[model samples]
Target: MSNIAYLGIFGPGPNSSAAIVSDNEIIAWAEEERFNRIKTSPNAYPAQSIAFCVKEARKLGLEVTSIGYAWDCNSYSELATANLEQTIAKYPSETDHISRLAQQGLNALYNPTKVKQDLGLILRKLGIELTDQNFKFYSHHLSHVASAIYTSGFDEAVVIVNDGVGEVASSSLVYVDKQGTMKELATEELPNTLGGFYATITEFLGFKAYVDEGKTMGLAAYGAPDADIMAVFDEMVQTDGKSFHYTVDPRFRYSGKRTFGSRFTDLMVEKLGPSRPADVSAMIAPYPAIAYAAQKKLEEVLFAQMKYAASLNLSKNICFAGGVHMNCKANGLLAESDLYENYFFQPAASDNGVCLGAAFLAKIDETGEIPKLPSLEHLYYGPSFTDDEIENVLKQCKLEYVKSDNIGRDVAQHIAKNDIVGWFQGRMEVGARALGGRSILANPLNPDARDHVNRHVKNREAWRPFCPSLKKESFQGYFDTVIDKSPFMIVATRIHKEFLDVLPSCIHVDGTVRPQTVNKDINPLYWSVMNEFEKITGQSIIVNTSFNVQGEPIVMRPEEAIRCFYGSGIDVLAIGSFLVKKGRR
Candidate 1:
């Protein structure tokens, strides 16, 4: 361990979360927004995030040897241009340079210089001197490929990673071996992504282009597709059911600026009809048929592409990571496809996993053997608060609390009784999906559980459905397929109709549900809750939601959870050894 050569550091966005890994194990991680809370400029770098990582590592008694930044974007401009030109020429435009988008300032958003300065500032804060060694830059798409392969636990797999854009490529297909050797089969660079097309559509619909595509995915479940719009989409993006692509016209909406406009809105309206205002609560199952249609089209193209990639390496398997893969619905489509016998999607499919992916890929090249100590289960990869640490905070606040003997089982009993319980166990989760560690638990079988949870802990829109976390054995009776074990809520599956009546709140109005299947092997604490719920209700499951109310990030710390609990109308709040009920203080 002392002779370890480097630490791989990756950030999904200059504005986003950071992750660090050594010897293929994640050591320290944090989101940039948590430390600053400003949602500020990426140009400022993630110094606060860096400081947390360094400080957290020091506590673990390990000095980071080498730091790896997730991108080598030196040729970003030239590459984006060439890729966009190809898309434009093949699509509606005829030009070499598509849009005159400027990324000069964007490049500096969370740049490497800022990271080093932030790292130095942290050491200085601890009264230590700066060192000559600095963070190293790794290629961006390669990080995506690495994340897909390394975490995938596949010796050989066909890796396909597609996102809006990376430092260099937008979509890359790599053939990888267990020994960590990767061969690139294809690279579809920027302005040529199907993902980008949806992003533009997202922006035109009055949402943030990059951040709001999930909204589009959600919206798509409601509408039917416009035949004409589908035709245009198909015309621009050509797919042979193996290789799929669309060339983006640089003009009209090229610069990644003017993220919203009436022109594209009018174009979509001209083809797909007017866009529906997203009153998330009132949307009928088929009301937004256009969204459904678009989703169907996107899945058709994406599934074909996956099959194509699978066909590329019939002898190997398939693995993936990227923003587009976050579409659990699309993943269901691909997972059900006959192209690959096995599937793995990076839990942090978005940019956040790039750091660990890049670092792990580099590490694999160094030792050719995986270190088996740290597993990727549960993603308890962020900061943790100790009993003493939490105790001091409660003492400082002069708040009274109950110290429970068995935190997991005691809380599980409350949930089994159909009580909504706010649970804060250990380290904060790193990715988008909240897996038990920082979550609210409730009875999934209670048809009114959704309404109660919404009215109480979440205040979520009615049209939005609550997902469930089920114990492993109990899944078979409620769900049609438990073979995949989608513990991350990545794939939304249709529940058995007979059981839907029993768990209406857990089942979407459409009869589909996304569930996290918890086994003792995956999450022991989460499993305890499910097991207890079964002992009481004759079923083992609970409705789970990210542990924050509407319009807030998931509460990360004990204090945040405590504050939110008091602020909102929550029933119970449990943090580590302490328990607080409504006004229990």
Candidate 2:
């Protein structure tokens, strides 16, 4: 009998994606939003994304035999149905007409049979017949653990998954042995969720809850963490040696609601002073202090949990996953503290990458043995274009582009002259952070480059810091702490005192920099441009930001890249081997 192939799907929320795998390899993986031009969460099922994965598998002449859903709807059947009923019961008397209708919609969304019907429809669109035996469901948190620990290449490690409510758990701690067996040590269930708490604070601080947490993180640098504010959080969220608990404040508790209720904002005002207004210019005095306090309290509680996990597992290696790990500053603090000898956070740590986790776990169940999977060295796992695809888009737009045999050197030359370059190369990346594939490259040496990109090109909050793409070899020279291996842009580290002014564009106000170290082997073309930039200037760092503007998804095609180049203040566009100047056509 031949080994079974698995197709993984993540849907019913944003970051809908699909992953296809044979017995031996991950044939392809992609987020539906990448193709559909949506941001993190999409409401529909991953039909288009599954189609892409199926097409990729067909191209490789592999047949998919099993389908995996990252979320276990059955696991949440009782709890979810109960929660929906409670909401509906309270709706008529306590809720308005609009609120009552919304709860009615939630009733249908949480129905287990509705989930199966949606899955069937999604499978049919992908040309796969849905069958009970052919499909398997994995717990959401377990899928996250599998994604991190399996790809970590660690023989044994402790795994931690932290995100918004998944089924009933908000945080989970498990131990994976040398043979890849997972043992659930403990879990902190809903209403006590760290992710939900952080998101509430995020919304209170005048930003989109799930989406703008990064902005609040950046703003933390400007204020001091107030003891009073920290005490408030400490009172609400408690951590023991082995397990953690949250004493829910009815004003601000996680009920698995899509949006935080008004009581959440009211509590923030009562505890931390008035919440920050949404008007960007109104960002003033106490807001930064509140952000600082929230961030510090979060780190304190989270690190305690990590320490408990470390004590129980007795492993030097740790595999961290979920949206919380996206806090690069906190990750940097952990890396600097020497808690773990090795730390692994997958490139797509959020819900988007759980598709890979589901597929890997399904593969293990089918074979009854852990396959020898290769460590992930690169994240170029999405769609790629051919030379003809590139030229055809250019021709369709009637734009003149010059094909270059040496695009790396030419693009480097433009950057050296302080020109902003839109770089689109190879396959699109599968995460929030843009690596080399879809990025905006600028000279880190330019004193004005950070403001130029933030204000002119990205039109984002000016205080938000830009990241540096540094040559891996130069890691020792630039940073105080010798963290030579951060490829995912998920870890923040301190900049050397001497190099702070030198790389001002990439350094945050707090003197920390989130750097993605580049190597020649993983991304040769991107590395070539960095090499040439370093040759021109003594610095081996370049300001690397995502290719998209503040509110848009990253550019997915050559035509989108071209449109962005012309729309923004960018001077040059480099897609494949072709180069187009903003006004040269």
Candidate 3:
């Protein structure tokens, strides 16, 4: 009955993060990459992140009593060893089993003993005891599921967690009852993972795998999936009612040689032609078409898998988690499907969110009760800077700045004048997308906004589309879609042709857009800025992109934001209540 403070830790891999839960409420959460300024540190521990959570909790008069590690590698080891042994017996010539065994020996997925020691060291540094009674571990997929279902506020829902690889299973389907009891029905093990398949294709297309999948999704709208490519993907995966299996011609499957140099790339090339060079500047023939084909195939397989799960679970509400759920295009299909009445994709759908899931799972195990938290109303749970912090950073850099009473309206007015502004306010967001707390803002109506951002600020592909953050009430006026409340920018909805020219900066080449619906209650300053922009231009949308350069992680601290403002092509910066402009002293 007493408030229990639980700390959740995820990763020593990509998208590592930490979260703190006080009984039924999440007090603070943050990804490690945000604090470290690294783009998903695959091998870094969440020491700084965990320390931040503890410090943040103390500020709120709470003490973390237990730590929940987000993965039980020992359980995964048992399952994987058995499964691989079975596969080796069944397929004598296949090398996937051997390669996977090698990776397992390296403890790529996890190592219980090693991780416990590391956690002990980190927790002790934070003045927490390192006892077995104070630490717990949850299975990877279960943690992913809990993150979605517990925060979803759905009494019962069909839970699906799909990612590159969790221990051994890449995807899992489960049914959660109104009492928060979960029954996992099926799992798709490694080598057969859709997450891996998509990552392979993303790499083949010259973008970073696991990181630039959004690029591939955006490019999908530009071309149609070739029937031949679809045939190849169809041959790679097959599904039954309750589960799915992979038949990727071993020659085309992952062999653990190079990240992108797999039999999979060769097979894709055989089917779709040579892969695109990563440095290519133009959206030429075959690449965009390949992206389209790959995305379409992914949607087809994922949708079929979802259909099978829905047939078995019979839940009107669905809670989605994992890396694959980050695919907004695929999410759009699921959202529009007639099988489910409502679907919720956690804002932090990637591995970065597993920390939250792990904490919730630990809470449930310790107390035998599901957290009584409401639906995830907002993701602004990370650290927020004080006005003094922002002013100190500005003064340290000797930058001329103006403090305004109405920062939102002042920033919005500058954006209306065609200047790209770095908007940093309140707590930092926990997900990959820059919702509002930390974002680069521009007038979506400006004809040159997209190109300027891509070429100068982002230094990424021009073909990639920017997202629009519009007031929730103005969503339907621009986009044509049935899935209404898209607060996370997870569903790529069709942009009304009439508004395409008006907000061309945010529209993709395929006429669809990923949009974040801003609600006043969740983010008042962001909503106010959007409203101010609307008052000036009669358009309710603004171009919203992560406030960082191409390869860097989103800005977290005030110093990082200030450094980024000076380093990039951003013309103005709205940090807390102060306004900073380029080339001014």
Candidate 4:
């Protein structure tokens, strides 16, 4: 039989994305935000991403045999309707507005028919036909689980998924046996969600709910946990102290009319004080304290849930995915714990990653047997440009540039001279991180590097930390952690006390660093640059932030990288092997 290819789409939500898997290997993966230049690409159909995946499939002479969507909307409808009815019964006064919002959400999110129609139209535009028989939808939480466990290269592992509501379930504990059969051990359903709680707290602290939760996680490091705030959180969500199950107070989340807003009701404001205004500084005392308390509570509750998962005694390995797993601090806590002998945290532990899972499920459904595959080595599965393409863009922009005989050494020299370089290399990375493919590089030893990049390059909050991309050999020397490798920069760990002052720009206030440990075999070009930097500075690390400014997706094309280079304070643009420099010292 010929090889089978499956196309997966994750969309009509934030971070809409698409991916293609063929013969048990991922061919292409990309987010719609990168193509549309919208941050997170909320509720946007992933047409451009689908186009990319199709093009990549064609290049490999593979036809898409099936299409899989990341959500099973039909599974969510009844529970959603019942929840809405309960909410209306509880708050009769706000019934009208609540119903209106519910209807809007249904039309936008929970309508599978609309998604099918949109996919058909998009496929038709791409010279492909979509049929009901060839397309299937998988459960959202199950997709999250598969994204981690399937790519983990483990025959048997326990999977934990935590996110905002997915078909009524917010959290799930699942066990995958040696035969690749998955058993649902337990689940925490909607109205009692770790994700919703975190998002509500994020929004309450003057940040966007889904988009800025990372900001809250970062801000938490600056404040001491407040007992009063912790007490308030205890009232909102409580565990049984023996199981993975938990309960949420309906008044705080998605239940009824609020004194403040839809995310939180009068009960929350009455207990936690008024929500912070968007214009006010997030660095304010109470805000940080609130963030700290929220982070601590999240970790405490999550640890309890995982401890229960371990007690089930199913497997020695554990895998994690979902939007909530993107919290590196919480992931760091879990990494340090002795709950599981081996752990695999999905790099793209968000809705976008569901495409990978959906594709894998489709493959299993089509082939009748699970394909044994190697663990994911890297995420460089998106678009790439040749040297000719970079040169053409440079010539069109009328910019002076040069092809470097040794790109790594040249870039290293610029970085050592304290120049901020926009480094756009081979295929873009699939996840949220820059990962050397599309990165802005700076010298981490430069004390002013972090502030400069935050202010002039990224145009974001000064308190936000920049990640360090270091050689794999350098990981153990700098960070004190059990994680053997962190290629995705998704887990934060404490830096050694001796090296804390050495990497001033890379170390966060908490003395922890989210590092991308670069293996030479996976990315030789990036490793070569770090190697060259080590030769010059005697440290095998460099500051690596995504190649985008505030409120924009990471640069995808050569033109976008050029635009960003000229628009930002970056002093140099390294596209492929060619270099373009702004007139600077």
Candidate 5:
């Protein structure tokens, strides 16, 4: 293994993160939101995340010799300026407005020298320093691709990256051969993005763009096919079945004054009626149908792209990254299809994963080859607390708690009793999903469990469905699907008809569920709790959601867990080995 250590920084935007790669392995990875307690941590510098990575790297006797940033600011500046100029030329009347918007957007794109200065400030704050020569800026889509392909454990694979404009490309298809050679096969440039199309609809439907696209995904299941809505969406994004390219109509996305407005234009409001009010219930007729149409269109275009990628037959294995791939419903369809013999989805497929991707790119740049690495097993790559540390927090808070002789059994018993539990175990998960590391656990059999948690704890949309964390062995029995393992909860599958009534809370209105199959060896404590729950209730599944209240990031420390336990409707706080309980709900 090479002795060189590389530090990677993702963004000063949403889902900012940092990672350290050394000795051909990821030493640490974390998102800024987890440390800042802000959802997505937009515009945050990720200083805390970098500090954590540095501390973790030090434990392994490693020091960061170089740094990699996820974006090539120079390329982005040139492309963005050109795109803006073309837009202004197309609509001469809105030149001033378009130019102002473009200036604001361009100013926000990372400037290499400014980024180096910012990094120097952050490093100095952390009692470390590095020269400007150590920094390298890579293309955004390349980082997204690297994050998936390098950790996919596949010698060869076709990688598809789709997101809201990375540099100039919104979607890219790259072929990775056995020789580790990467070839950019096809790309869909800006203004023709699947992510932009979805985000536009997401904002129109009264949900925050980017942040609440998943809410739209969940609402889509409740919506039936609507001809008018589907037609409108069809007009917005046109896909060619024979090719990997698609065109998004600018009028519905970022055209004229709409670029400075709510992303969607007046034409969209005229076609679909005025945007849904934030206070209004999303369950209303046209809104759900709108979400459904948008989702279907996204899937349609995505499947076309994937099918084209497969037509090349560069490799049977396929890997996906970028924010758009976070749509588990689409991922589920890809998983069920015979398009690929094997599939790997990066858990942190969003910009948060770019840090790790940049770090890998730095390593490759240094070594001149992609390093062979094991497939990413679990996302327990964030901070972890010891029992002693947890106990100290408990004592400081003056909270009554008991150290469990068997935490798994104890937590399972509470869950069996229909109690919502905050299960804070080892390291926190790195992605949007909590997995088992930092999750709220509940009995899946209780039909009201979903509503109870949403009303009292999550404080979000009641129609949104909760996911299930099931034992790996029980996957085939509960879900009818060809794909066997989905450890990250990034794919949706249909629940078996017979078990529908048995695990009511876990299944969505469409009878589909996003499940995380827990391997015993990968997450022993989590597996043990499910195992014990099975022993008690004859069911090996539990409803698992991220351990956080509405509008907050998941808990990262014992204090945060304790605060969440007391602040919300969660019944028990099973943090580390200590169990703190409240009066039965």
Candidate 6:
């Protein structure tokens, strides 16, 4: 039967979710907050996300059959040690909220019946039938493990997943075997979490906890790593190689509430005095220093865990999908190290990607083989519009525009001539990084391209480094020791000094670049464009940055691209089947 059997819904949190394994592919997949956009904890149900999935399934000409959540918070993992029913009864107030919010928020895990009700409402919204037999729950970390190890194109890989607390599981290690099957080596429940520690440090620095860690990562590149604070982190984080534990520097802990604790804040003050501090009057330079210190320490502990995991699993290759793996710089360090011969971090490393991971996991469970690797050619996963749709927006806006010349070729020539051109193609990508599909391309030789990009297009923090999409053949010659193959712009590796002038913009202050190695096999059009530019200019890579300016999402529509073209300092814009250039640039 082509009818979709198993379905799963995640609410985009470090909470318990549900998953079902049916005969065919993942029947329906979605997150709760993609519908509400407010997000839910694991205990919450994906009512809205489910509705959208049902709608999408209708588009696929199928009716959903079995519905499963990604969580067996019903069983036990981090959320409950053993008797989940008893645990909920132990916390009645939280349990009451669970009842009311089960359909929406993830409090369902705390209260089992609420979880059942949450699933009930999901089925109700779809106007579909359900059964106690149809309702199967999953363990949160098990879902995480299944999502990564099952899908990665590895016969055997050591898997690591970590995110905000779920089932009390802050970390886990999975060993996917040669048969495309895996077994859980061990799972680390919280009170010893790198993610938990990162979250606390994130909020301590005046940002939202789980959400602001990227901000802190960007902030870290600007600061100095103080030895004292380095000492603090060293003493606090203990690692056994396979997993880690974080003991907050008891002398200066703040429940990790504020961006800067009295002790940490004070340490910042003592180490690096106020740099232009009349505004806030605290030691600001040291904040990034502390952040750098924290990030550096976290990487050390994490790599230690990775190394231990490699040893335990005895897999030369390691595949990672977790919140901790989101730290690309740390990934870079791992790439440089000899711990794993091959390492792959899932592009959608965050929780949002888990939906795909869950579906992939279910596929793995059935096939017992690494589902054929979907070419990482591009990340064109979001919505796309047709010419009429684009033209309608264009006509409605009354914009001056005509579809221009051979877009890919002309833009390639322009890039060869050292011009910055915004190339918006196919669809916007699904993750944090922008691949070639939606990017700005330029000749990498221009030493001034970095500042030019910052001043004109990005207007982001000057210190935030630029990324390069390098030709696969020339990759090793231009960059020193680029062992990791990250077409996703996730790992930052160094630019060899001998070739610094060849691709100046791609080089960071620390002389590293988050390189996206392009090959005809991986991303053909993008590769061709870069290849054509390289042939003309004698340089094999292009300075590629996201196609959006500061304080804005990447321009989605053609008119938006035209608007950005005129408003920003971009010399050219590549719309589909056309080239639009600003006059007198």
Per-model TM values vs. the true structure = 0.87, 0.93, 0.95, 0.97, 0.97, 0.79
- Residue 130 shift from truth in candidate 4, angstroms: 1.6
Question: How much does candidate 5 score in TM-score?
Answer: 0.97
lDDT of each: 0.66, 0.79, 0.82, 0.88, 0.88, 0.62
Model 2 per-residue lDDT tens digits across residues 464-565: 899988788888888888466778799999988998878778899999998888888889899899888888897778999999998788998887898888
Q: What tens-digit string does per-residue lDDT give for candidate 6 at 245-349?
A: 333342223222223342233333333333223244123655777678778877877787677776664788787777777787887888787777777777656
lDDT of 5 at 424: 97
Candidate 6 TM-score, true structure as reference: 0.79
Of 1 and 6, the candidate ahead on TM-score is 1
Candidate 1: tens digits of C-alpha lDDT, residues 334-357: 776666677887777777677666
For candidate 5, lDDT tens digit of each residue in 1-585?
455678889878779999998866888999999998889998878899999999988887787877889989766676777875675566444434755576567556576677778888998876667675677889899899889998999988999999998877999999888877789999988678988888998899888998999999999988989888888888989987778999998767666455334678878988888788867899997999999998999899889988998898778899999999999999998889898899999989999999999998888777677867788888888999999999999999998888899999999999999999999999989999989999999999999999999999999899999999999999998889998888999999998899888888989999899999999999999999999999999999999999999889999998899899999999999999999999753
Candidate 3 error regions (>4 Å): 1-3, 85-105, 240-250, 255-265
* Full-model lDDT, candidate 2: 0.79
Candidates ranked by lDDT, best first? 4, 5, 3, 2, 1, 6
Candidate 4: count of backbone clashes, pairs at least 3 residues apart or interchain: 0
Query: Runs in model 6 with CA error above 4 Å?
Result: 1-7, 12-63, 66-68, 71-135, 179-181, 205-208, 222-225, 240-284, 361-378, 416-420, 482-484, 549-571, 583-585
User: What local lDDT score does residue 387 receive in model 6, on the 0 to 100 scale?
Assistant: 60
Put down candidate 4 lDDT per residue, 254-308, tens digits, no spaces.
5556667767777777888888887778898788888998898889888988999
